[model samples]
Target chain A: MMKDEELVIEARDLTKVFLDFWGRPKVRAVNGIHLDVRRGEIFGLLGPNGSGKSTTIKMILGLLHPTSGQLSVLGQSPRAVSVKSRMGFMPEESYLYKYLTADEILNFYANLYGMTGSAKTERVNALIEQVGLSQARDRRVGEFSKGMARRIGLAQALLNDPDLILLDEPTSGLDPIACREVKDLLLALARQGKTILICSHHLADMQDICSRVAILLQGEVCATGSVQELLSTPDTLKLTLQAPSQTTLMAVLDLLERETGTRPQVDLTGRTLESVYIETVSKRKSAS
Target chain B: MSHYFGKSLTRISALAGLTVRDAARSRLLVSLGGILIIGLIGLPLLISGDNTLTRRLQVILNYTLSFAVTMLSIVTLWTACGGVSSEIQDRRLYLVLTKPVHRYELWLGKWLGIVALNALLLTLTGFIIGIMIWHTLFTSPESETGKRQACEQFLLARQSRLPESPISEKQAQASAAALVKSGRAPAGIDAAQVATELMKELKNARFVIAPTGTVHFTTLITTPLSGINDGLLNYKIESSRPERSPIPALWEIQAAGKKAIHLSVTNYPGLPNRLLIPGAVMKNAPSLTLSYHRLDSSSSATLFMAQNGQEPELLIPSGSWAMNLGRGLLMILCRLAFLSALGLTAGCLLSTPVAVFAAFFIMVLLAMSGYVESVATSGAFYIPHEGHELSKTWLDKVILSQFKGLNRLTQPLLRLDPVPLLEEGRRISWLLTTQAVAWLVGLYTAVTALIGMILFNRRELG
Candidate 1:
């Protein structure tokens, strides 16, 4: 009896301090963090590098124990293996056993979670096809490029069809196309009612699919809310109108300024590089 | 709930599966296996005492097995190191660490994996040697051939012969008991002495002991003594196998006090003076005694005499006395366990291999230091002045000082100079048992626990 919108994660004053070999303090990697995520939501933890977003995610997953404080997932301790049996993880880096074939790596992980026999085979095969890595699944993980590795990592992370999934920098090293494919995959998983916690520095990507976002800075949550809420402020409006020549835009901005009082600026007078690039690529695809 | 998890068995089995596969694929392990077979098989064929094959088997038991343990333990370092360190290096540590698994499970799994791997390799190697030995026993190689010279002539000669099965069990037991009660054993109240006295009591017994060095030359090893001449069987140089021609003794009928002792070291001789130890003298040498005065680095000696004929080296009389193989095996396993324990502990605490290796080196040094305090302790090598009786505490400290243990066959195996246990093996299995327990349950266990704790505390996923 799984509850929809039930709290899947809860952290109370979670703190993690990294220590040196001699047990001396080195860094307070994460500090006094409090967070909760409703079940079946794509929760995004956004931050720059070393911002403790990944640390927080790991704590939620029980890959790391918090130095102080407590955390639970699905009403159970993160470290409970039984709970882990219902969880999947995608680390920031695909630190997979290189010597193992992708198939072997998947099987090893499946076995770790106690998935076995036909169920394991069926799940691994489906996930491989789903992640679009069916062709390369037999290859040694060592032979994989970073992008390919990330694809396999995603596939393995989904093997258990876990109730809670944690993805750290899931699309960090993928090509744009691959990134789009992964984004679509996350959305599809979300649509299927899987809860996901993703940690990423790519704020744009986070903003796109996340049900809610937690923006972190220096081991603390700076802001947390839905993407639209965080993006909207009384002071700024991101207006997108039909593109114009610089002269026409300037005139329009002057008129708008006269009406609105505060300075209005003519921005991106013509299609920006990203827009142009996307358009060109789409046009090529259509022509093909 | 963490206790009695069925996962320990499951994890160990999975890890063992991987471990066996890995070792089987290793070229070094395979080659090492092949060489060990050749050595074990070829060695027995090369040497045969006219009277006892048991003595020949003794050589293999004492020396070859020690070497095996050393090689196996060294192999454990790489296996154990790769078990975790390589995973971390390749960034694959995250896979297991993040699996909602207990940290201790991973550590324990890895240890079990490596040990299972080592045991497989060593046990297989041991099996091959065992089979060869089994073959050697069922069919004694031309035992009816050695020229039977007159007994009195052989007895008077300066010989270095492997022991023959002349002494009976009763004689060996009597002698071993006599040796212990008389305190004639190298160290007082030593297990070896008791065993040796018992062995001496066994006047007419035939048994094969493991590898031991013997010197039956009729002469006091040191000090000016009498009537020694050439024409006698002064020296018989043999490789690990039987030889057609005897190698000449390095020392002939030499002068007195100047000291002329033939020394051919198969491995570095144990801690003591270099002397002519023949194939017989070491034959069933009473479990060797490791005598080290704590805090004292002064040299010590072990004098083993494998009598020329009818002097049963070991008291035991088995119908099919192959050799003392299982005797030191427990000790060997214990030593390996300790080495791995130390290595694993260091590996956990320090991410750096150099740091870990350094830590391992320190552990070995400490164990060896059990012999005597290092000169690094203080400038005190020789004995104190006669009238100056040192205090109990200082003496204890000095006695417990660090030392570089004797690494005869391999490096200081026990690190704690486990000679006393060997010396007392016959009468007192306790010393050896104690050392084994200390190794298995003490250093190795403690270090393994430490390793587990460190690993459990580590944060890898982040």
Candidate 2:
């Protein structure tokens, strides 16, 4: 477990109230929320529609001003330009310059961060290749497919190699293969000691990746805990074993049923379909 | 300071490059260029010069060039407006602002990109017109004499010298006092009204010549007239006699410390006539003195040489035509830069269509700035008929007064206009170009960029 002292993000009573045209109170998008994200942690913000997940993420990214609260990323105000340089944000949509090619889009962002010369070109090419868009690098973004555009967006978010990467619905339009790639990429980045804040509704995906999470409801945190603490069934015992003979499995189930005075539910033990699919496709790719 | 500037410059350069790429790829740019090319090249094919190749060239330069400038300005404003407004609307601005770019950098970068594009387009069209004009001049069937005359008078940048400055307020006041004392003005007449009336009258007043008498006037020559002989003197002669007829006269021109020129005026109709003087006698003269003798002893006459009123002028070559054209275009570019800044500021504050409409509205107002000036200075919206005073209502007074204030605010921005000078083949003086650069491109652009940056920085992007 990472130490709690190295906090990369801190919020105290953080709130954001969206106003009407007249600037009167219209809706409370985030209400008095507190959060602490440590360095090298994969933190997830999970919620349903209108539950303030995206709004909270936007506030954290300094896109929206809080009504009343203190929020900081990298020990500085989110609005700080230098702080922004060290951070990256992938918004809910792929808001890229449609007229520019993928290569240009990455290069543009890199240059905005004051990167230039061969270093910029090399980084841009590497990003394009990493996002698996090397083939379509020259195609205009407007001509790219939704999945391809999402991939490019991810690549741009990583262009500066930011320490604090914020991804909002990062896997929304990605294919399963791309989704796995993104999840693995997040893990790899976390291993490299980068702080990641992901706002999404994919519970299974979040469970597979997030070390800690906060569930929001009606602009408030309904629950907050580590993945194990939140999802683990303390009252139940689980066993994982290789598939045995049918008789052996039946005897084990009978013993459990007799002890509990109830029927035991049995299920097949196998790899997840996603894992199997990835394995099959990768094997085929390697053979080709 | 240098380090920060260098960093800001780098970011601004990147954003400007991106903006240029976007503009180049836009279909609107291509469409505008197509229209501009058609208007520039195709219009000459459609219009006949009426007779003379000089007239044809004049029409092309006057109409086609003006049309091209207007079109380019409109397109430049449109591109500038769309460059910022469309980015905000499409949410692409979100991506950009999230980077480490300052709002000022973004604003300046957009302006620079639009300006760069305008320069390219203007240079291209200007080159085409220049080439076309030279080709037409070389290929025309006019004799060498006609060609040389046209080249000397129409194709060169000339400076105009008047007899004197216009009648000042003090002169007008003196005239008003004479009129009041002479019992011409009614008792208790409005003194301000009388002064204005006298000013207008003095502006159009004629120089009177008694029968068989001589009238002398001296003019300070500012430009050099060193070439072969030719001068145009515009005059209107009116005879005070029972039988209306042309008056004959002897024209004597005495240059400072030079041999005097004597020519006989044979025809002087009631309508204005242009007298062509022979010999380059006015050359190397610091000033010129004209003596008009009324040789027609039977009739008295009046001569009019009003300033800017079809007055007699001595046009002297001052500079090269090509350099003058370049200066004129540079002035146009300055105005375009100001317009681009205004469009960008509006775009930052409003949506695309609204910003475009506002910019166009401002352009129209600037084009009609003469009316603004009149209303502001005279407190009258429109000039009255000859010898009549305007009856202004309170509403007219209030509205015109307000417009007067606005005119005072925007006068500096609207003052320099190069089109007329270009049409007349007059030198666009360096002073005027300097004023344009100072106000239009420097002060005005900076203010506009500041306002845009403030608005954009305060804007909430989602």
Best by TM-score: 2
Model 2 lDDT per residue over A125-216, tens place: 99898999999999999999988998999998998999889898888888789999999999999999999999987888899889999999
Q: Write the per-residue lDDT of candidate 1 for residues A1-288, one digit (tens) a residue.
A: 777868889888889998887999899988888888888799998888889887787777676789998888889988776787778888878777666778877877776666657998998888888777888888988899998899889888888788888998898888776787799889988888889999887877888889998888889888888888877898777788778787998788888889899777545556556556767887998999
Candidate 2, DockQ score (0 to 1): 0.66
Please write out the lDDT profile of model 1 over residues B258-302, one tens digit for every residue. Answer: 333343322222221223222232233322111111111221222
For candidate 1, give the docking quality class from DockQ: acceptable
Q: What lDDT does model 1 reach?
A: 0.59
lDDT of 2 by residue, B15-121 (tens): 88887788778766677778878888788867755758767677767887788888987888788788788888987887787787788889998888888778877
Model 2 chain A, TM-score vs. native: 0.93
Give per-model CA RMSD: 12.8, 4.5
The per-candidate count of clashes, in order, stands at: 72, 0
